[model samples]
Target chain A: MRMSKIVRFSADVLFGAILIFGFYIILHGHLTPGGGFQGGAVVATGAALVIVAYSYEEVLHMIKKAGLMLQESAGLVMFAGVALIALGLGTTFFFNYLANSGLLFGMSVPFGPNPGELNTGGVLPLMNIAVGIEVWGGLAIVILYMLSGISKAEEA
Target chain B: MIETIIHVLVIAGLVVSAILVFHFRDLLAAALASALFSFLISLEFYILQAPDVAISQAAIGAGLTTAIFILAIRSTKRYEEDIP
Candidate 1:
């Protein structure tokens, strides 16, 4: 894949910028417009840009296939585990266990006079993080598989 | 009022990008445009107060998916040919 100098530099810069921006989104997801999954995908896009500019072989070497699969599965299991923990605590699935307990970092922190306030305790933020990881990892795996398959086909 | 205007602009950008994705003869360009569409949709999700969905869509739909499509198409050598 021969790319012009301008194209190569542009793609590299765009890819790097998106990756950084995605992390920013993930970290501040609870307080901002971006979250884990969105940011993670942005990170993956940066990886993809490298693949497009260079070669799939090089990209694969950088991001191993096995590691991606493990990360994806781990994310799914972690999410399910959290749901099960909620059930075990005598609540329905995905109940805000921490919120109901009035606990923050194991200390009794009360909600500010109102139950549904934005600052009130809840597991929604945690769920958001879990889902973000799951989506990012799963999508990365899917893309990696597709790219690897294409590369194999080319080799044959 | 400002929020509404921003929302409208984002939606307009999305629509324009979608149109470009379909109309462009270049597959790579179309894929890139589609990524832009995904980003806009993510922003829409943010507006709708569903950051989780927005994040998922942005990551999976725009980032990784676009790269996969581009690489797969590149390997196939069909991107160079015009679509009928």
Candidate 2:
């Protein structure tokens, strides 16, 4: 069942902020306490809030399961591809091949207590992003599936 | 110290909320109480200096889990059936 006007309005307002913060957590996973899993979970909560605020048909129009399934697959493939690339580079799997190599997200870190930059952590940021997207898709799919079941039962 | 007092208070509330969850005959109320329990535990995690665990718990434990429980209740019964 959809909520009242205030609830829907608040959900819409908070969705963007929550999504941005979730992305922040995912992007800065390497430099912050929150990583891919945490950020993705945060984003999923926001999705749930929005879903709950709207009718089932409205939700279905906004979010499709197939799209989310593809998102999940893409994230998993990206994670694996990043790991496998290390083998092609003649390094072990999950290698920090890009670290200190002056590429994107490869700025070398001096070992000390200091402010961290986004352009570091080699393959970590990519891996974080991959896992984040996968988790977001997986969790949101679960919520959608539940709502689907409810709608089905209601129809019967 | 202030920190110690805060920890005690949070834990106390956590225990109380847990008991309320068990005591509630209304499943919806129980689900909400569990969310409160989750929120308190997340606070405790933050107090214990584990923001990662805290964030995950707050999101999954409080948010997603509550949503799932509420949906389950909506599909079925809101009050627990007394088999006795």
DockQ winner among the candidates? 2
Global lDDT of each candidate: 0.71, 0.93
| Candidate 1 lDDT tens digits, B1-84 | 998998999989988998999887778888889989998998999898897787678767876677777776778654556449
Q: What is the lDDT of residue A82 in candidate 1?
A: 76
Query: Once superposed on the true structure, which residue ranges of model 1 sit more than 4 Å away at CA?
Result: A1-20, A34-36, A100-122, B1-19, B36-58, B78-84
**Candidate 2 segments exceeding 4 Å error:** B81-84
RMSD of model 2, in Å? Answer: 1.3
Least accurate stretch of 10 residues (summed lDDT) in model 1 chain B?
B74-83
Against the true chain A, what TM-score does chain A of candidate 2 give? 0.97
Per-residue CA lDDT of candidate 1, range A59-153, in tens? 67778878877777777788788778899989899876876455541224444653233343356556555666766666667776776677778
Model 2, A63: alpha-carbon shift in Å? 0.7
Q: Candidate 2 on B1-84: residue-level lDDT in tens? A: 999999999999999999999999999899999999999999999999999999999999999999888777877878888888
